[model samples]
Target: MSPQPHEKRQTLAHRLLEVRLQGRAAVLKGHHNTNYVLRIGLPLAVVLGVMPFVRFKYRVPLKTVEVVPRIWRSEVDVLAVVCRHLREVPRGFAVQGDRSLHRYRRGIVLSEQNPHGPVDENMLREFAAFFVRTAKVPVKELPAPPRDWPVDGESAKFLHWLIEFTERRVHLPNRERFGDLFDQVGIPADAMAAFKERHLSLVSRRFVLLHTDVHRANVVVRRKGITVIDWELAIYGDPLHDLATHIVRMGYSPTERRQMVDLWERAMQAADLGPLTAGLHDDLDTYVDFEYAQSVYPDVMRAALGLPTEAGDEHFRVAAERVWSAMDRARGPLELKSVKDVDQIMEALRKWHSMDAVSAETTVV
Candidate 1:
């Protein structure tokens, strides 16, 4: 039988250790998981993308098992396009170990000399060119989504599918525990109001394959151009949603974020695919909210695992600040109800420590 939940977490943790013990790799922590980089290696530099699985109260529910394989398959599909169509990005070499489920892309790891932040003008322009090229790739040329994968890629239906996916993942798995979080924080029980389809109009838009999780760590600087890594979260959806996730997830300052936005608009228009830009100004916020909503469960549960029981309140305070910031950014756009202001969230976090800790278990790496 497969290992139990806690055992799975330990196994993943051990897998990380195994790579680290290899003595040639440097540990680079991504937003959600920790990846190992051996940039200097020859034919391929392996990035073992293992991290703590989420700590839901139960096993990954049968309902959610579909997300696992579907996402993996999507990653495989999107990577094929990047390899075949986009020279501006990295080539995802197939690996033997990845045949099991979770795998990593092996390539040159961009270092401080070549980094993901500090916005490069040329790099941004090239990224725009890459978008034009990606859009031009014929539909038949791109790989298809798996059988059970949601087929709707239009703005409206895709948004609905994404919102529902986040909701079920966040609320259903650990209903009472997550509810207690809301109750303690003073968020309305109906925190999903923002996700319901309404005034949003997505006409003039068609879906394109998106690097949905475009953050600094996942993107690496290269001599030829910029190379994006970590394809597991890749999805087929509104291209603006890709931009939305990129801006929020990447720690760009307000000024930098604005700069990137201006760059994207100019680039897409220049590429002659300007119609995809429709509804971007008004609807991008909704996608940002969805990202935050989708992220809270994993963030909270991960924070719980490292409470520093013997260390002190300092760690707790730090984690609370992070979680509060998540709620702060997300709640307004999410129309998250019953949220107990920041002070309340801090208080709830305090009470939470008195109870048993959130366990480490099978997670999405």
Candidate 2:
């Protein structure tokens, strides 16, 4: 039997992505996916041969916590919805098996140009415009939300669901492996509960499509405008959540963050999305708190997991500082009575590394 068209596309994509291929191919590695980029030329009959440059992305298998529903099962559905409405988003042609191909956007990542730098007024306005455009997309056009997704426009329920997801998926799943380390670093099991209780006053706002992960690295700056890539983490939720994540992940200074919020409010108002910004000033911090609270688990766990097998004291020190910083930021939200000192965190990392090494040796034998 002949291979299916989808199968052929997958095969060709894999072939073009091979490291041994003789061409100008670049492998872009990200936390969740590994992308292989190359330009090809051929007859119109063949699949994707006419494109200037194509990116073949395969999801990397890793033990990760699920904070939001990834359209990984069929990214094409969401991509269709987003690209149809927003030209700045890269269009995904197809998702076959584990591989998905996208038209490569030729530009420098915003992070490369300005890492954790302040955005100028013009760029800030553009960023706000993108958010406004995304927020205006009708939910009917989006793929069905996950079964546990909160009802549309239910901001309070959405926040509660997020807390539940963090507790159920992020914390419980990894408790067996990292529970002790979590305790050593001052993260108690009741942390999420306390956070949820403190943040119950979230003002209701109409939910909308949100690019949940809008960090600098995910944004490509072209001469025409900014193209936001990596829509895998996109979700339909309170718009403020997206803004909060962007502010935190973009590493904006205090003044820049305030300016960005003002710009976002103005843009939304101009687009007649005033309702979406209702109680934004009052509730934005709650969303920011949630971002901090939920991130601590992954930040600490990834730090520990990222240590090299033969890591020395310096590695442990770096990992400890990373974990400590996450804890410090989360203290207000999680109501942590005290944060673990750097030396304490370093000792805990050293122990975890030793145990991890022993486990690896056992499996090897």
Which has the greatest TM-score? 2
Runs with alpha carbons beyond 4 Å of true place in candidate 2:
1-24, 43-45, 49-72
Clashes of each: 14, 0
| lDDT tens per residue, model 2, 1-365 | 99988777766655644432465667777777767565544421156554543443334334455545463366666889889889878777553455566777878998899886678888888899999989978889888888888888889898898888889888988887789899889997898888888777677788898888888899889998898888878888899999999988988888899999999999999999999989998799999988999888999888998898889889989999999999999998888779989999999998888887887889899
Q: Which 10-residue span in candidate 1 carries the lowest summed lDDT?
A: 54-63
In terms of lDDT, the best-performing candidate is 2
lDDT of 1 by residue, 169-267 (tens): 655666554557645654445555445644244544777777676665666565666667666666666787788777776666777767777778788
lDDT of 1: 0.57
Candidate 2 displacement at residue 115 in angstroms:
0.9
TM per prediction: 0.72, 0.92
